[model samples]
Target: MRITLHEVSKGRAGQALPSMSLEFHSGAVRFALAETEQRPTVLGLIASGRMKPDTGRVTIDDTANPKELRRRIALVDAPDVSDPHPDITLAGVVGEELMFAGVGATPLHARRWLTQLGYNELASTPIGNIDPAARVRILCELAVLRDGVDGVVLVAPDRHGGSPDGWWRIAGEFADRGYAMLVIIGGSAAVALERMQEFEAINASGPVQPLVLEAPADADADADAEPADEDAEPELSAAEPAEAAASGPWVAEAVEAPEPDPLEEEAEALREAQGPASSIEASDTDTDTDTTENGAAR
Candidate 1:
């Protein structure tokens, strides 16, 4: 199945989108490099079936209603919309997704996919326990659990640092398995795109071009638009790495856990040893009696 968007335009906070059009063929992979805000608007419009092009149309294999094609389309790792809860177990996350899509969560089916994706060990682990790269892999595995998935759109694939070619490899895998893949990267993301010769790419992050607005009397009608700052680009220092994301596997920055005080630890241990009986007594007894007992003990 193919998906096509023609002349689609959207506005966020009154800023209009620039001539955005996309086409994803079956068993193919496509990439879109866009500004942070613009990516979500375009992706959300396609996912929710609410996209109405100001001039053209969005169609999936000739079908107009995107809602009807929901079963065959999957949006994985989309910012804000489809993010997996960090606290949920990996299995729980996938199980809920399977149920939502009306698929059975049998051990064989679930395990097979997880293992194939090199994530079986993390199945019982919470999503927060795994690295960002692993989280992306898990979501992709969940997308193909049901049969006949025509397309999968991944937003902000560069959030997790991995092989510069990692996403392209994953997309190629999906394409080989008969699913069209669309990977959206943020304009500010540090990923390198030189290795993506096999995929088609669209650049949507440039300065917004003038378009005939649907409403003429909107804001900024008289004010001159400011020119982009040429000096905004940072000069690289000799010590600073040019491409950090491409240098190695991105391990998240470690947070310094507070050291435990001995007194606090002892007090906590004492409370645990006292167990439910102490808690019950303190809660159930009269306030006056408890105060008197505390004074007598002291």
Candidate 2:
């Protein structure tokens, strides 16, 4: 899915916003610099299709369709539209959003949801006091829970106060997960991010510059990789295990040797109890490797 705002403006005769054009599509996160306290949010609302632009148009996949755009794009942290009440407890916020998401909305369900998101301990904390990056993370997670949401317009996260890298990374992760993301940020925040780009190899994949990793990947693949012939599969199989040795130690450290089935393990333990005692050899495990994974080490 892709969303594009073409010279879109809002408010009295477009005075509220000068025309601005920007585009973001599935598997990408784009940033827009809006300095005013309210323009940042207004831009987000326009980008997400929550509010109609008084001037140009916002389109989904290059077609002018407000309903579809609104359905697919989640307006995250838009002031007065999606922001949670400052005083609401974290659990309360989750419960309310789950209600909107048509999931079970009971407190127990909310607690479980937060636990899975690794925010269980913050359940009782006021949303206002939560860390800014965490606030953006939880809110973005909740926004995606709504059916049909495949994109997010995160508004003014910098206004919450923290390094732009914090929430920027989070947005990049969403994009990596195949969600189209647009982050509306302040001018100073954008400047800071510009300086940050020197030392960090951040995402510049957006048509515009300035993107983050909070899973920022472009699915760049080796187009040059040669496909093996069908008859070569058996030949390749013999060498595959040897090739896997580079990842062996890392994989082992990530995952312990598989346990036997329950009954077998129990029998093995029983046999060990009856067997004579023997000294166990110690092995070094501090080795490191360049192995990488999209999945967990374990």
Candidate 2 lDDT by residue in tens digits, 1-298: 8787899988887667878888999999878888776788788878877778889998898899888888988898888878988999999999999999999999999999999999999999999999999999999999999999999998889888988899989999999999999888888888887787754654454455557644323333443457666644233345576546545443433434665689888889998888875454345433432334864443
Candidate with top lDDT is: 2
Between which residue pairs do clashes occur in model 1?
none
lDDT of 1 by residue, 25-89 (tens): 77887777667555564654564354554555677887776675566777787766777777888
How many steric overlaps are in each model, in order? 0, 3
Q: Which ten residues in a row have the lowest lDDT in candidate 1?
A: 195-204
Scored by CA lDDT, what does every candidate get? 0.67, 0.84
Q: Candidate 2: worst 10 consecutive residues by lDDT?
A: 215-224
Model 1 segments more than 4 A misplaced:
12-17, 47-55, 106-117, 188-191, 195-298
